[model samples]
Target: MRSAPGEFEIIRDYFADAPIGEGVVLGVGDDCALLQPPAGALLATSVDTLVADRHFPASADPAAIAARALRVNLSDLAAMNAQPLWFTLALTLPHSDAAWLQKFADGLLQTAKAYGVSLVGGDTTCGPLSITIQVTGSSVKPLRRDGARIGDAVYVSGELGAAAAALPVVLGQKLAGEPDRDAAERAYYFPEPQLATAAAIGDIASSALDISDGLLADLGHICAASGVSADIDLHALPVAPLARQLAGERALELAASGGDDYQLCFTVPQEQVATLEKLGLDAVCIGTIVEGQGEVHAWLDGERWFPEAAGYEHF
Candidate 1:
């Protein structure tokens, strides 16, 4: 039998050939990657770690895990209206299985290439399975959480709650029809980073973020940063069909507070709302920013509504 691969062997055999995009002075195989940011543009960077059984199932396909890991980190750049550039991976594995490593690397590099990002450098070590990725990008006009103002309109891209509702199916805690299972897996493992949507609204949005911790919870971040509150029309939320199919009447609530959607939620000033409409983007007005101290109020049919939980908490 072939001996299990070592760290260097794994790196050489798997990740060294990642796409070398523009501005990468040096890529994988270096102790530290050398990157060049666009002239007069700011660098936007974010990192995330996904642990086995916490972030994903331990028995999940390695490729799917890798794809999800990179895509989620890329969502951060999209939130900042940044252009994808480079990334680094630090992977931990309990054992170095070549087949598993190949699948993981293929998924990682494919997603990276699709996003126009290059794998710069990373490390591999022996431990429980986990993936840590740091993505860096460039932004000329970065949207910030603190930019929202009272009277701004809140909007979200695509649909929501599908990923959250999909979780039960993904974890095998709930049995689903094959169609539902496929939809759940797609929602959970392949959330598209809203790069194009961000680009379309970057100049007009007052504040922006990707919804990873449900819409309400992530929107609260913008409210806190901008020192404003929001009043949402719960009936106006564009609930995902997957959520509706799986969660029944609770779909709306799941859409509001079940995390993992990775879609963009942004605020557009009343004046620029017309401009946003002219762009004809795939987003819908869900609420309005109001004068308050970071509270998010929801109303259903002119009556107050509440969610069962705030969102996913690390603790």
Candidate 2:
């Protein structure tokens, strides 16, 4: 038999004191989480969770945990070109440790402050040390994956595969003073969500999304969402030198099927190439969205490169 799911009684006694945001006439203690949407701007909301052994190591630094937990959610807001305004955190720690909470909260506040976001509310409880943050943002017109069109040039904001490369090291696999271990570990620990870059994309990019589930899989999302297919040049993929050092010639495999790279993969009209170039985003034209459907293709030196696996999948 399964254990009973957590109930509101448990939620209220522990987490009821957290402040509700602006215009929240009646807060979470009641029958529902009631709030009035902020004036003028459209609301954007996203929820993300980080599990101890799954998303990060149990031994991972608290500050890094706090930062990454927030960054990934912020990446979703960025994809919509929304300016994050506030967030609610729900933390489930194995046990209440004052020092750990202090460090984690401090990191959360610092990162939120840097992004001009406030912690409006949250819930805390006892569990297996998991963190879930729900964030809200404001936007004039939110970008959607449905807008991609044929002939649009697909671009990614930064290098990929560092986080995937770090997986082995996280599992206690020894490395020979390898720099990829450090780089990939950093990528996994402190994932830069490219919020500013994504925000700047604005109407320029017809479609956009953060690459959390590897390049090929996430690009497949855009294609499926927009009813299009993409032809990515495997050689054109911006493989970081550190990732190259780690995987050797199989670097493309890492970039293709390795997940956890939170880079923004987007499509822009060919006309906006110059504008995006001026942004100095370390952007690369990796592929083109075409009028088709189904799996995205990776062309390596004019031949197809099909990985034995697709990407990281929970369950």
Candidate 3:
């Protein structure tokens, strides 16, 4: 029989030491975590769930899995230009191992503290390995998908393709110890949420989203929501150098259609490009919103192109 611990014991041992953020009026051990949203700011909430071998490899480190689970949710908040306030964790495990739980909790709480978020409340149960996190944030005026407009320039933060490049190695398809493989592993395990950039350019961004799905797919979402189209320049993508190790066009394909990048994709007016540059944001101008509805056209040397695959969708 698998060893299981009591729910309260799980909480007491693992989640008790979570940081207390400014918005947490009441924290763990309560029926409901009480949160006080900041004055003049609307609460932004997002939830993400990761199952073993689906969202992550079963062989992945527990701490890395925990961090990725929470960070994905935090990336959503960042997309809205929100400040993280609090979070609740729901955990399911085949069996409770003190060491594994402790490591997971350490990663979770440490990440929360780094983002100034508090762990408020949650539940623990015996089941398959899974984690669900609900994060609440605040924003005076969050960027929305519907806010994109024609003539807006699309921008993406950071480099893409590394996390996707690491997938083969993570699945044991590629050998470890390669230079690019190591970088891909780091990118896959520790994707940074773009909170600082989001906050800095919040007022300037017309629409914003995180690139969990491939860039083209997620960019298409903004266009669909805004009833527009996009023309992306292949030459302008901020692809990571790790992708150069790939065969011809595979790098661009990964940057276009491979998932798990978790970078921000946002739209801004051409007039605001100087303002964004002055803000010192790490980004690249990849495309422009046009009149067509929901269509994303990729261009290389003035010709239309498309990625070989679409983003991941479980169905």
Candidate 4:
């Protein structure tokens, strides 16, 4: 009893006169959108998918879901130290709901405007709910996870584990008392991808990756990719006061293995740590890379510590 999405309706309401690129030679309503890049620019493209009951909750507001979908993709670009330029959207929905579409589109437009990116081309299909976004950017140099070197110090931007902490609250697994639940909720819903901060780090950081997974799990990617070992100091990690108070002794558990932080984690030389300190970035020297291999385990109070939970597993 639902209407199938047709190209004509989508064109008139959603795609007609859609803004594409500043240097777009061919925009949408064509076989493919054509773009012309500047001579000195290098193209960086990333694609991400958000499915209902997987990437996000079915009950979440459409505007927030749209913003988060775009933000998560943007976070990937930020990890590579690229400035976002344009994007293409592919949407699958069960039916044409005008109210929901309006909110989703408004959120998408607002997020794109905020990040200086433009919507170029895409398609809409009738199916289960899903959003696929491909964003493109330009960078002279891309920060990769494999550039970490022996003797470089590991650093993380902002506090860790708030997003994971909020998960329990959202699912009714935990009760609200202090600021922990509130902080966690904010981190989970409105993740501020560290684009400008990563750009500031530039070539200074030898290797970098965004912390979408737990700290140890995400850092393990850098370690495995770079063939190095990382030693993290539990005391050195910056845990939010609210989370620490709520978690008590379990603070380390949340910090080590909780996911959805969306912060930048990178490795910098010991000598450059001082320079980075002056930049007003709340970067913490939580660990150091050494001439070894494998994922990072922590040392707290001179005892080997392992978190009970791992990062988010898509399986």
Candidate number achieving the greatest TM-score relative to the actual structure: 1
Residue 271 of model 2 has an lDDT of 92
Would you give me the overall lDDT of model 1?
0.91
Q: Write the residue-wise lDDT of candidate 3 on 69-110 in tens digits.
A: 888999999999998988888888888788888888888878
- Pairs that clash in candidate 1: 214-259
RMSD for each model, in Å, please?
A: 3.0, 3.7, 2.6, 3.0
List the candidate 4 regions with Cα displacement exceeding 4 Å.
1-21, 172-184, 245-249
Give per-residue CA lDDT, model 1, range 1-315, as digits (tens).
343332344566687668899998976654567887889999999999999999999999888999999999999999999999898888888988988989998998889889899888787888899999999999998999999999999999999999988999899884545547888899999999999999999899999999999899999999999999999999889999999998888799999999999999999999999999999899999999999999999899999888999888899
RMSD score of candidate 2 (Å): 3.7
lDDT of 4 by residue, 63-96 (tens): 8788888888899889999998888888988898
Global fold similarity of model 4 (TM-score): 0.90
Candidate 3 to truth, TM: 0.94
Q: Score every model by TM-score.
A: 0.96, 0.86, 0.94, 0.90
Candidate 3 minimal-lDDT segment of 10 residues: 2-11
Q: lDDT of each model, Cα atoms only?
A: 0.91, 0.78, 0.84, 0.81
In terms of lDDT, the poorest run of 10 residues in model 1 is 1-10
Q: Point out the worst 10-residue segment of candidate 2 by lDDT.
A: 1-10
lDDT of 1 at 315: 90
Query: What is the per-residue lDDT of model 2 for residues 199-270, given as tens digits with 9 covering 90 to 100?
Result: 788858898888888889988988999999999998888876656776666667888888777888899998
Which ten contiguous residues of candidate 4 have the minimum total lDDT?
A: 3-12
Q: Native-vs-model 2 lDDT? A: 0.78
